[model samples]
Target: MTSAQKPLHSAFGPQTTAQEALAGRDLRGKVAIVTGGHGGIGLETTRVLSNAGATVIVGARDINKAQDKLSTMKNVEVIHLDLADPKSIDQFAADILKSNRALDILINNAGVANPPVIKDARGFDTHFATNHLGHFQLTARLWEALIKSGNSRVITLSSISHMLGPIDLSDLNFTKRPYDKDISYGESKTACSLFAVELDKRGKEHGIRAFAVNPGAILTGLTRHLTDEELAAWGVRRGENSEFISPEGFKSAEQGAATSIWCAVSPLLEGKGGVYCENCDIAAIVPADSKLMTGVREWAIDQTAAEMLWTVSEDLLHIGSIPGLSK
Candidate 1:
């Protein structure tokens, strides 16, 4: 009866693209929601799903930008959603509930990377609050709709950075520890992946499966926080003299969106959930190799950690008693 007890599966590999991932799939009458669907990987995801006949709702903070990008899409609607604000999430969920009870897919894609250190209304660290807790609350609020949809899935946008950090429950807000922005973002993303596992364990019987996806390295607004020098130092940037790009390289926005679309609409994943995915396939459980910044870490994918983080988060957010998820 809890998400901690479910099995998981994998899909394709990182080289797969959105078009390739959804080839031969049909979403004719399904309803899906993609957060931050106006730009980068999110935009490509919106485009692919909408093209496949799914009525996609673009959850964005900037209504104008969302509409501008999705202007030509027939069934796409841009809705204002600021994840940092619980009131906004509640209002959006209420509107969705009134409009339709069956939501086939929910993509927790919108996230703030390393925005200049700021605090949200909840007085939590900006990255942790917006990236993890915000989506956590949103998913909880939308649980009813997901269950009503039958065989629905929630795909969370986690990252390889999750392997680098763990949930600092005591100092989640970074109020006491030395503020390391990258670690803060990593912690939040790790929580995102764990949350998916926990959700699948708890809601699988209700036909709600959850998956966490890492889009791999893509040059997008999400990386705007890191300066050119920092990126070069990290070996993520390319030299001007380089000829053919590396196979294991940074993906384009469309490529970055591939795994997300696959997880959202791929038939290959039916009845399989609660796994961390990348490159359009279920990433293998590799050893914690610092060289390869991929694959799910033990802690991030651990059911015990997932449940503990869930309970702590619920209490922090003042949500309901998270029954079986406590440490």
Candidate 2:
């Protein structure tokens, strides 16, 4: 049930703001969960969704900070969720399930930048654990609520960096090969896209469509790990006054959040799922040799690889069978 990896020639572009994406839509009664939705583009995402009448739940590790940051935002509440900790993820899912709410949208958005070779409790790479596995487990745990909606959308934020490489199923945590931050980051994002591939295959039958989003690079906490020199390489120069000299393709936080919500609500995507999207359109599959910054790589959408990753992820989380999805 994978959708075609081709653009819709959409009216939206890289510059579309989150606010503008939801301009004419009314989302009253829709319940959405946005992990790490209290900061940067996630904040803007939460803001836009809340403004449009959705009851938004933000899952954050720092309860107080998240609560404080989202204090003024209406139709929103912060819940404790630390993606790195399996216990925390389980509890977060349990809390939501208690409400018996039908989750209309689930944005697997909380992620950490590549900061060396950090690992979770199970010694899995943080990038793989937090960015992919955590979300995978969370989504699986919330399967009941999602299917209850009968038309839920799960949007995972992948990145164009996925073009750098695909996941190495043999050694995902750098246990065998040397650790490279760029490769680690790229592979994790690739996993994000692949999650959509597999999830859509399994869940679309139950009306749970999945999408992978590339929210064009925007300055946020995700870049805090990089040094000034590293930032400069990306064309992000800060003056003595701390003003920005941004790169040509650099996006504002608002603009970066546009495609995410668009994937959540756009009528154009009603029957579509399982495609990697960029700039508010379904991205084309580029040649593996492509040096281009846009479009998805064939490996990222490889259905076989996606199914394997899903199995590996279930084993990693020790959450064996996905009731209706498992063979």
Candidate 3:
């Protein structure tokens, strides 16, 4: 069910690496796509899935860089995808659809954070447009391909920072209200969580299940724009020389990728969808006023908010009600 947000006490924890998450699984014959797959947590996810014999399609804004980085990997394809551009999204999805292959997994793992206010071609907030709307459109466009697989999993990365969200659909692009970077980023992540909620609700009957993942505090490219001081302030600490940490410390990129990989492949989650997962397990729900950076906030998992966000997203994209995305 979409609202089963309780933890299953999986053996895995915050310290699990992407490789560890898929330790005994064989993904041969499976196909997966990872946005920003050439770098950081996404890279780890792509590597593990490909190593397990799954074909990995990596969506990167910088095609050359992505190709170069992934050139040596087996069964990996790099495609140009500028999330802030609707045209690029259409082309990406069209390209995939043209293949006539069922897409088994889709990790909407690419996103922008902490940048100066920037807008897309349609004057939408770059954070909201690229992070939320772009992935939303891409998923919608690829709905047919996903449903082709008898059972498909869609993993969208949310954040603990979503505690600040319940996005103001009224001012999504900051057209009416003042724009604050953290708030805007939070809103985008919040939007991502809600998207999973509604998408799982609508797609489950079709053998497609969606989940939102909170990948813990990993220092990845998403935080590149942040300074050391900002990192400290945000509580995303990292050791100078470690890519794995004890459960008590911050996450490494590999560790951060675990929950996403788990969401995509773990059999334990086969019958579950729409829950917010963290530390490679379904997280508990917390009150709106909570301060701890664990568990999902009530607003982020509210069914009403999810439904409203879906409609607002469809309206903003001007895509209207479509087959897989309609409420």
Report the number of the highest-lDDT candidate.
2
- Candidate 3 lDDT (Cα, whole model)? 0.89
TM-score of 3: 0.94
After the best TM-score superposition of candidate 2, give how far the Cα of residue 13 lies from its true spot, in angstroms: 0.7
lDDT of each: 0.82, 0.91, 0.89
lDDT of 2 at 213: 97
The TM-score ranking, best first, is 2, 3, 1
RMSD values, in order shown? 3.7, 1.3, 2.5
Candidate 1, 6-69: lDDT as tens digits: 3234345667789888886889989999999989899999999999999998889999878988
Between prediction 1 and prediction 2, which has the larger TM-score? 2
**Candidate 1: C-alpha lDDT:** 0.82
Model 2, 1-327: lDDT tens digits are 244888999888988998888867999999999999999889999999999999999999998999889899899989999988889999999999999999999999999886655887688999999999999999999999999999999999999999998899999999999988889999999999999999998998899999999999888889878878988888898879976678688899999999999999999889889999988889888889899889899889999999999999988889967677676
Task: Find the number of clashing residue pairs for candidate 3.
Answer: 0
Per-model TM-score, in order, reads: 0.90, 0.97, 0.94
The candidate scoring highest on TM-score is 2
For residue 21, model 1's alpha carbon misses the true position, in angstroms, by 0.2
